[model samples]
Target: MAALCPNDFKPIGWLCRKKRYSLKWKLCISMIFVLMTSMWINPKLLMSMLTPVSEYKKQDITPVKNSKHLMVSAFKDHRINGSTRIISILNRGQLQPLFCIFCCGKNNYSTPATIDMHSDHFGFRYVTTDVLCRNKPKSNAMYVTLSLKPDVLYNLTDFLPIQNQIQEEEAFPYEFTICISSLFGSYNNVLQFVQTMEVYKLLGIQRVVIYNTSCGPDLEKVLHYYSEEGILEIVQWPIDQFLIPSRGWNFKEHGGDIHYYGQLTTLNECIYRNMYKSRYVLLNDIDEIIMPYQHANLHLLLEDLQQEHPNVGVFIIENHIFPKTQFDNSGQFNRTEWKKVPGINILEHVYREPDRKNVFNPTKILANPRQVVQTSVHSVLKNYGQTFRVPPDVCRIVHVRVPLQSNLTKEQLFVDKKLWEFEKPLLPNVDNVFKKTGFLN
Candidate 1:
């Protein structure tokens, strides 16, 4: 070997003293080396480390829930998880995606499934979970909230989400109960309201559940009297403050926040509320009555119907429009006391508009509350048993309202005097209610 200089046998890349590099360059090289070593050691770990960055770059990691931290469904294969009951879509905003969550005991559901809902004209979607509880041992209750934003946590029972209990055999005081929804914003039709209630009573209904949003002071007094007497159950339905509910059933034409003032939700809720309690539930508007022509009362009609159709859970009563224009010409009896009332005396409106050919007549229902899963304005949306449309001869809806169709001649209309049978008792009953509510001084 030759005599060694100060830098003899130095590396080709090194300088006389030592190789120099900027701190940034050194750090970069070191990071690259570490990354390569890490990838070599475990490629999955490296990919995992980079995944967040990749997701961030794509901006796809949006949290599932919003800031309100409402409850949302979690995916889990719980062996004992049950079904959902009365699953109506709560609300779907333009910014938030719709959610179908579990809010009942695990025994309620038969199988795990996703519910689908579509929008009305305004693009509002609705979906509800459907399944009866199994009521098996070891089943637990669960609640889920559908938050508008992603990845937000809501308190349990914050919204009092659906809770499907085991359907116990509860003894309901009423053999027949009526459910009416969203009576909002100081509404008053005293005559019609009294007439409807009297008719319901005459038809053997023992209880009426009204989800009252707001009512006229006079109507409130009547409602209060009914409430105190235990004839009516009033649910405080202040839906306007919470939501922009729709005024009409058809969302496009009416353009409301909810459909017909959240009637569907309330109807579903009423079915569940009276599920085990009442033997049957009658769904109709205050102006409509499911008038039985052949049978003396609904109890008898239902008894005969049950005997004929053993498995039928729903009885759909056809709607007949009794235009307010028609009045009883026969001077058999005068509603002398009711003359001062604001609404048409139902007794006087006997003529019904003829059913147009190929037209969809809106219907009302007499349903076994236990078997009803979902409902709409006209008919049962879902049920546990068969649904049968009762013939017009046996029974039909005595819907007293303005004529839906135009250009009807007197000859075209037919007289439906079915409501007359109950008139004698109904008149007295109305007078008594008015007297009791202090409507008639």
Candidate 2:
């Protein structure tokens, strides 16, 4: 062999020097090679691997403790003013501090919430409260979670998706939506429910939103029927599961934790839930129907009333009681097919009790939801415009239930068959529902 020089072993020397590089540099080169190979194999797989995990991972936070004392119901984004309104039920006397934690991708921003207990708590321990949180600029938060501490871990609270963020104008999904809140006591009343629903259709009501805690089997069938028809939306209201709900409105008399099965809370929730969806929202019970005496349909009645009271947002209609005990003399609507139904026949009860002299008669409401901030069973607590008491001749709610004035006789009551005016269309519609639901087989 020829005499060996350093030049003869140059390739092996180069390889040895390259191996002397730092481990970090070696790993970097290896990663680059793997990434390039992955890209050639599947670009989407490489892109997904490079993307942040937070972008696709669903965040599930633990539900807060002591939810009964301070239960969060819903989150609404008040797009009109760019603020968030948190619907919650809190102890009226509770002094615990609450914070609104806004979730923005991987980060969270906390803000002190201004708790506004609704004035119509009715002396109950728990009340409907509005926890208002102002949106922070550039937070880009789409959901909110409630916590007692300002610096809560993102995984410690349940996230509520913010709703009602879309601002709608003239176009709306429903012209009139009837809101029946917190149906409890295993409410059945199949015949009356069907009658009322058909009457609502006659009155031009396009939607009926009911917060149901519990109902009997017959009523459930009726609810399912209307829901399948796309005319009713049932919101599951398991208030009793969370708190001791009262049977009556007054806390002292009713003797329970929350007033009237959290009726006020459901009413206000319905208002906000349907704010941008419905043009008008009528807050009343299933047994009561806002019957118009003068106009053929509710649309015309509202059209004229809105024209007259251009600045008014709420129109309070007097509630007249049609005692279920008294029936029409003719018994014209007491059809044999309906006798088996387990509810009062509203059509048969035509005589309404005379309005008590110099006493405050509780009224139901028909309001422009866009103008209402909060609502109660009888009236709107906070509104953007004037509240007008609609004339009795124009409209009134036909409330058929246990008589408030039980002393009145049939002869003493007024003969107001306003419901009969709707019988032509109402009866057949109700019959069809009953037939379809097999209530009358």
Candidate 3:
């Protein structure tokens, strides 16, 4: 043919002609045909093939590293300023060059983080630390990766979503919230836990945040019930999976890696977690209740206190141990229905031990979380404003547990019936919870 038209030419026929195409060219044509066929069948296959492997990994969040020497629990965007606060538990006295790699899709902004080990680690080998990273200007970072090198693509912790950006003092979702740190030891104190929750409700507590490492089945059911009711937020804290946690506060005697199940970390995390959510956060144990003696409810108590002591961030309430061993002779709250419960009935324990002579009594806190920087079990370590120690007559934590004053007879204990004031509402509320959780059924 003098000039063959393009439509009359057949590439496949030409390739099939003997010795018309080399082996290399034939293989290349076959690959091109297969690829084009595949693309025609599914266009997405070509896109996936073209995409880099590293880009595929960005789809799923990596599992948080707990087994590492430095364990990060949560990453929060500090509302006071556009900074990143990484709540972590790390080995004490072990220096490491930790960097915060802020991830914004494919790009990362690496910055040096100031590692501040909590002063209240109590000499534990493992301590809670706050890794602070200053935010880069005009950065839209979404996730943070803590690593020795800035090029780390793993161990990323997504910033906790801020439900409310509280710019005004009056813009809090909850007026009062309770923070109970690291509940462990298969804590089956169902009765006390319920009682405390009821007491919290009566005291105007809108929410309770419990960091639970472990609990019994019965307590788990109660937790679930309260969680469904929107009163309790149970945070799953598997601290033991990360490090050797001590049951006792002192590391020398307890001989564990971390102090009291990384309680300091949980407390601080709770504070920051609820900083924009709650107006005041009460840091106490499940066995304790921050009872307001002078006021009708906690709101009223706080209102009066805040008015009197303006600019006070922390209000330290003295903890008074109401011995479980000794009960009120009246037995007014000794209901027969609660006999089957697996925990101490707090209503019956009203006799609080007298404050020891020349000894510092341990206290709990009701704090303005936004004003706090760092906290210990009993008090705030760092805060923006003043600290007010509330008089015992005004408010105190009614702790129902073992007798702190073992030597003192029951008669010597002070008869503080502050908890009894809410017995009317507390009883019915607790009974309702029991019925719903199938404890009574």
Candidate 4:
């Protein structure tokens, strides 16, 4: 036979030269060749060899997923292995790392079905296709397995304005009132408290009514001044607050009048007369300050709160001991010290308002504001009084009394203990009230 050079390539010559097989290689090669040739020659044999890839996997692979059924002739007759190859994508780092496996295009079908292959391990099976997306063609025809679940993702939307508007329209029905006694001066310790309370207007408390039992003419003048200023409301009772206990009536904790329930007669009267006008009534001393950062007014705050529980919305705020530094009055023991407590803005004004600094509580809305009430520990009674929850949002009961140099609260005890307990304490500049009420006359 004439020697044929490589340039005379009839494919077989080049194949024989390049793929020179040893005996063992030829043996395996002969087997594969015989298998390929014999199967191609007999149509029935080829059909038998080309069973569904799913059958090889002991499952059924559809036209999209079956490897054996994939015709690489869909290529330019340049045949390649038709099975799918799994490529793993880099994981941003999680337990079951994500992958970027690839396979031929014609084989890949539904994304969920492909994911099932990795999760179910139904064995490798794929189809023939060009790995293309849009008009951009992949340099190599391949299928890539992207992360089924990615750590980060984005969405297109516009859905929060509706939620905001709904919240705005629903805000209403706020009602709260503050109750106190002594106007200003008689029980000087509470002067700081009165100042602190001025901040309550920002918290929904619009009106504060003072019930006076035993204030001197000076106190009346002070109250009258505030009343004219449109800030204070005064209700006068001619008797001393202390005489109630001797009359077999004790409004405070010390003296219990069996004839009348343990509650203060005045407080009981106040409840009956004003409960309807206000959704909330605060039973506090002039030395006590109720603090809340919820709303600009107590009325509006209660309305928001009423949305929480179906019943029972009264809240009892615990007392916080204020700092002694707040009471420092430059060594002055006169009524001026009691008049102001100095706010963050003014060092001279003892009655200056403090800055808001407490945390808010998560609140449940009450169904009925009328259902709430509060009682003193001294008031021996059943818990059945209409009650409400004091959400942390509006929670505060600062008893700025006792242990201060101002002899204000302690001085009152000597006057008439029962009276002091039943009625609220006084503000400091109450003498100004006397000048206004003409009580001195």
Best by lDDT: 2
lDDT of each: 0.65, 0.81, 0.79, 0.35
1-441 in candidate 3: lDDT tens per residue?
A: 233226535345334222256799999999999999989998877765665433433311122333344544334455547677777776766667777777665566789878888888888877777878776777756556567766665334332222222345678889999999878999999999898888888879999999988999999999999999999998878778767889999877998888888788889888888877899999988888898898989999999999999989899999889999998898788889998888999889888899987989999999999899899999898898999999999998888999978899988988888877776787788999999998886
Q: How does each model score on TM-score?
A: 0.71, 0.85, 0.84, 0.37
Instruction: Give lDDT tens digits, candidate 2, residues 266-331.
Output: 888888888889999999988889989889889999999989999998999999899999999997
Residue 109's lDDT in candidate 2: 87
Q: Estimate, for each residue in 292-405, the C-alpha lDDT of model 1 and write its tens digit.
A: 888888889998999999999998989989988867788554567777766667777878898878988778889987776567667776668899999998998888889887
Between candidates 2 and 4, which one is better according to lDDT?
2
Better of 1 and 3 by lDDT: 3
**Residue 204, model 4: Cα distance from true site in angstroms:** 2.7
Which candidate wins on TM-score? 2
Clashing pairs in 2: none
State the lDDT of candidate 4 residue by residue for 239-340, as single tens digits.
232222222323243342221221132333333234345555665555555654455445555556556644544555544433333433453334443333
Error of 1 at 93 (Å): 6.0
Could you list the CA RMSD of all candidates, in the order they appear?
14.9, 7.5, 6.2, 32.4
User: What's the lDDT for residue 79 in model 4?
Assistant: 15
